[model samples]
Target: MDFYELVKQRQSTRAFDTERMVDREIIARILEAGRLSPSACNAQPWHFIVVDEPDLKNKVADATSARLLGMNHFTKQAPVHIIVVEEKVNFSSGIGGLVKDKHFAFLDIGIATAHICLAAESEGLGSCILGWFKESKVKELLNIPKNKRVVLDIIIGYAAQPLREKRRKSSEEVISFNTYQ
Candidate 1:
């Protein structure tokens, strides 16, 4: 499919086919997309942790869900969870970030997350990028270091839900010719 069509078709898949499992090769391809993403000064301040083992993935899924708040309850249904970790930026990127007063690492990771999602779509799979979760619990479960930060959790699987119409603001509402409105 074309890139625009792929973007239109890609949605935050909330339901997944638990009976099916995503292939490891496909997962590697998805990860490769993220790895190839550009970063500020090539710092590449991120790491991806793949949780595919059935029992462990379930535990990681539990860390991403909150029943009381009704968020990410369907994460367990997805067979794989990729945890994004934030790492220290290189000297040049760090200096640039300080000079601009911007968190470039987060921005780069966000781009990588988009690449991963698009790759999943290209591979005929569904994905959801989750930010709200019990980060400390996930760290314990995955044996991630205390000093490290968990940036995002992406769940991938065969979508059980159908593709719904996408609702968005009009171009005029978000775009400007040359100056702020």
Candidate 2:
């Protein structure tokens, strides 16, 4: 698929087919996209933990949803969840971030997240990037080290819902050429 079209096709899929499972090959490709994503100063600074086992996936899904708040309640319907863990950046990337007052690790991870979502879309799978989960619980469940941080959980599956049109700001509102016009 065309890159532009892939970006347009990628959306936060909320409803997913409960029965269909995402193939391992497709998941591998999506992960490959993440692995090859560009990073500052060659610091990858991210690790992905894939959860596809029925019982464990449900437990991770539980960590993501809040019943009273009605947030991410549908995460359990998806067959897979890929947890993104933030890692330390290279020396130069860390120094550059400190000097520039920016978090290069997060920026790099965000780019990887985009690559993952687009890759999933290209593979005919739906995905949702979830950031509002219980991080501590997830780490404990997955045996992640205390020092590492869980950044995001991405759920993937066949979408059960129809495509919804994307609403976005006009190009003029978000874009500015030379001199920030």
Candidate 3:
């Protein structure tokens, strides 16, 4: 699908078929999309943990409270969960001082997450970006170092239900000609 079409069709899928599993190659593509995202000064502070093992997924679900996006129980049933984290020490700091920009890491991770979601939609897979979680517990469970911070969790699988339409503000309400009202 084209970029516009993918953006229009992408929706947060909550209900997923437990039996359906995403192909490893497809998952790799999704990860590559994230890895290729642009970052401040190309710091590339993001790291990913792909959890496909049932036991680990279940642990993440349990630690995430299983109610991340309202009553979305299928989040726990997804065949794969991609955890996105940001490293504190920027590897590309030698180019400049991108590491000093503390908030840049989160921004970079957000861009990467967006790429992953778009790629998943393009590949006919369902996904949901989850943020509500106990970060410390997740870090411990995932064996993430203290220097890295969990930014987002993406659940991937085949949808079990139809995509639900969400409400959005009209352009007129959110846009301005040159200045804020």
Candidate 4:
């Protein structure tokens, strides 16, 4: 599919086929897409931990569960989980961030993840970018260092749910020309 079509088709897939296993090559390609993403001053401050093992995947899913909200209950059905970690930024990016007073690392990571999800769509796989999870528990389970921040937990597999209509603000409602509306 074309880029626009891919973007339109990509959605946060909640339900996945538990029996199917994702190919390592496809996951590699998805990560490669993330690696090629642009970052502030080319810092590329990101690390991806791919979890395909059943035991580890379950552990990660456990960290994502919440009884009150009932969110992320479908994660256990996903076959793969990619944990995105934020690393130290390069000097140039750091200085840029300081001057701009913005966290460039987060922005860079978001861009990288966009590439990952888009690539997954291109590979005929489904994905969900999950943020509402127990970060400390995830860190402990994955053996992540204390300093590193877990930015996102992405699940990938064949989608068990059908695509739903997308609701969004139209261009006229969200876009402006030459100046803020």
- What value does the lDDT take at residue 164 in candidate 4? 80
Predicted candidate 3 versus true structure: per-residue lDDT over 17-69, tens digit per residue: 88888999999998999999898778888889999999989888776664545
Q: Write model 4 residue lDDT over 46-157, tens digit each, in one string.
A: 9999999999899999999886789899999999999999999999999999999999999999999999999999999999999988999999999999888999998999
User: Candidate 3 has which clashing residue pairs, if any?
Assistant: none
Error of 2 at 43 (Å): 0.3
TM-score of each: 0.98, 0.97, 0.88, 0.98
Question: Considering TM-score, where higher is better, how would the candidates rank from best to worst?
Answer: 1, 4, 2, 3
List candidate 1 segments past 4 Å from native.
none
Candidate 1 local distance difference test against the native = 0.96
What does candidate 2 score on TM? 0.97
Best by the TM-score measure: 1
Ranking by lDDT: 1, 2, 4, 3
Best by lDDT: 1
* Ten residues in sequence with the least summed lDDT for candidate 4: 65-74
Task: Count steric clashes of candidate 4.
Answer: 0
- Choose 1 or 2, whichever is better by TM-score: 1
What C-alpha lDDT values do all the predictions have? 0.96, 0.95, 0.83, 0.94
